[model samples]
Target: MPQSHPFARVSILCKTYDPESGFNESHAEVIELHDDQPEAVDAVLKYIYTFEYDNIVRTGKDKTRPQFHLRVYRVAHKYQIPKLQHKACTGLDRACRKITLQTSGSKNGSSSEELFELIKLITEHKQYDHSFNTTSIYLVQRYLSPLMRLKTFNE
Candidate 1:
């Protein structure tokens, strides 16, 4: 029987095994990770072994950086990995800053349609509520403040 792999030893996945018994002698266990995103899992695994992950900040029309970070954060939280959670949160904050800058600096700013999509994406994820992080709340406030001012004056 083969020994447990090094990567599995440090992860929460290993907690299921009894320390007194060798993992190789135990019955085969199948763990299904249906709720986790493959990309997010890959990123967390890479970070676990290498202490590094791909930057979430990139210029593109996709705007999936925040989504990726959110997914990673969820995975980390589920797996009880504090270090990964911290990294994911930091990445999320950074991505939010980049997104804010991109939208605010645009010649016409983000269109109402784009803003609506952004709001929908954030609100759809429970992890993005006001208590999750200040950056997310700040982003929403920043975008809404201008609209609120315009509406107040127009009324």
Candidate 2:
């Protein structure tokens, strides 16, 4: 199929896929050629969601996986978005507290109940405000480990 978007310059010097080594064999074939923005986005999303860094590490200690690019991650740190960072911190704190409570609860006590209590504490504390959309809230909660460490607003 022909790509619908204009071709954009890609910075990759060279790439190779070795399925026996566990890299996505499919992406290996086409990644060397320059691609359009949409194609690049699609490819990156697929790789980030599915590619396992551990698997690549085992393949070769020197070569890192194509999953989350180190360069991109560095850029994120350089131009760090404050609001998102705050949300991330709050989410992490809540997650750590929840995990601790869950682990320390008595063997006879219910894990579900403990989780519910933690949820209650978070809600009562108003860590998330009324303005938070469902998707953003979900993302913050789901990635609580990383997000909770951020300096988020009290509400």
Candidate 3:
């Protein structure tokens, strides 16, 4: 682990090759986190241990899948894991693609409607995700904006 990386500074004995376990003899070697979403937390752990998170989360045409990536992005931001944050953003964008998206709030809605909801979600979370200004959000906007224009023309 690189000393400059914030995550490298974390003292996880089993993971970091430290001689000390960090846990007292009576305490279990479990790490506790406060997030309510177990699946997202599991994805985070998978990424940490294996450096691959995409395969673990099989959204499988699920319309609400963007929320999973958002959860991962939030955790990454809180932990200052930039690469994971980027990956989560990529996942969100991929899920919201014109090919995969369903209506945002309804099963019978069109792809354009789903895309609209995704854009709304991105704007709503602009404050929490600092990278929105510098990276993926702009890419999302560039990719989706033209489609939005076309959608208006078609309607």
Candidate 4:
């Protein structure tokens, strides 16, 4: 791996690679993460190893599916994986588009619960100002704007 790689850049990974710590001596090949969601971790690993990920567009009844890309974006940001971050952004954009399409023709647009979840995800990414700002703007422009207009018209 290159010295500039995200794995090398992350302090925790750097510590694990330290020869003096004896961590690499005993488990040189294994890196164990205890407190992360398996799906998010898998997405990061997939991007790191393969430079790509499948199923960026999830299709199912799972209410939490829309947040998956956001989770990936958060993980990538935490790990300093720029490429993965960009990919996650693309995935997130796609997810937002999908959500917009799915809910567009409905009387009130998306369910309150679903919108709440998306809002929560957006809030979580607020520290990542660039991504958060762009995403929030996109959501407002694409989804909330039309919904608001509909409500205004109804009123």
Candidate 5:
């Protein structure tokens, strides 16, 4: 039997342009990433890197074809939820440790630790992405004030 396909947990659809024809086009590819663990740091780059659009177009393969794009969307649609689950698991581990330490001892049972955990989890709903800005919101707001707005009236 044929070997099962190696799957990608994250994907990007690429639309490139043909300078000569002044036309834009689409294609897709599977991205293998290098990282410490599942969904950590978002190792998969964009999908445009893998295809040979110019070469294929020049060779007339695309000119005679109405559907030159590959069937990568199906794979992307399949694995997207799993990739998100992986990212959530990774972020939760970090946030949970912080919450645990921040709440080491609490007589009232409701503490800063609990608040922080709630905030971390609620904030995590914003996709828990692995971008530089995602990791360093303070740096972005401090250095590039115009790039962001204060989420609350306090600051």
Candidate 6:
């Protein structure tokens, strides 16, 4: 880790672990992400090292899946990487906007219930977080009208 890297400022990595003390010897050098998805972790690492991460979440037709970016945002927030968090948030917002625009918020888009799932996902991860709450608001207030109008809008 270089001196200028934002990851260098993360508290877990900044700990002065003593080589001789061997504290938590089994995993002293590892930063476990038990709750994070592998792709999100990969994206965070890629951003940490290279500062670019658009390709990891793209599906067919250049349409980025919002769930992937949401995971990236969660991991970035957990690791205190504000830049990556913001970037992922922007990606998610754009993805939602793109989907809604492409389907004109009707017919084809109503089947894509991931907008509601995204809100549920954020709530599961962090109920008290401003970022998560704001994202939920954006999903519900801004982009959920069409889906909400549908009769199958359960959960």
Please provide TM-scores, in order, for all candidate models, with all chains considered together.
0.59, 0.20, 0.54, 0.64, 0.24, 0.64
For candidate 3, what is the TM-score? 0.54
Cα lDDT listed for each candidate: 0.60, 0.34, 0.61, 0.64, 0.31, 0.67
Instruction: Write the residue-wise lDDT of candidate 2 on 9-99 in tens digits.
Output: 1211112244445556535546533322333233333334544323423344222321112222222223232332233334334333334
lDDT for position 149 in model 5: 31
Top candidate, metric lDDT: 6
**TM-score preference between candidates 3 and 6, better one:** 6
lDDT of 1: 0.60
**Candidate 6: where is the Cα deviation over 4 Å?**
1-4, 10-18, 25-32, 55-63, 101-112, 123-135, 141-146, 149-155
lDDT (Cα, tens digit) per residue for candidate 1, span 1-155: 66444365465455555555566424557555789988777777777776665443232333246677778878777766666666777766666666543355676345544554554555555553343447646676767654454443235
For candidate 3, the 10 contiguous residues with the lowest summed lDDT are 9-18
Model 5 C-alpha lDDT per residue in residues 13-104, reported as the tens digit of each score: 22122234443432224344332222122222222233222332234422222111111221222345334333333333333333321235
Sort the candidates on lDDT, descending order. 6, 4, 3, 1, 2, 5
Candidate 3: residue 132 lDDT (0-100)? 46
Error of 4 at 123 (Å): 2.4
Give per-residue CA lDDT, model 4, range 1-112, as digits (tens).
Answer: 7446655565666675677778654455766666566678877876676665554334234423557877777778777887777777776766666664335476634664
Quickly count the clashes in candidate 1: 0
TM-score of 4: 0.64
Instruction: State the lDDT of candidate 3 residue by residue for 1-155, as single tens digits.
Output: 74345347344324443435554532546656666466667677778777776766664345247767877887777766777788887777675453343446766544655555555566666787654444345534555654556554245
lDDT of 5: 0.31
Candidate 1 regions off by >4 Å?
1-12, 15-31, 54-64, 100-131, 145-155
After superposing all C-alphas onto the true structure, candidate 1 shows an RMSD in angstroms of: 7.8
lDDT (tens digit, per residue) of candidate 6 on 44-78: 87788777766555533432777777788888877
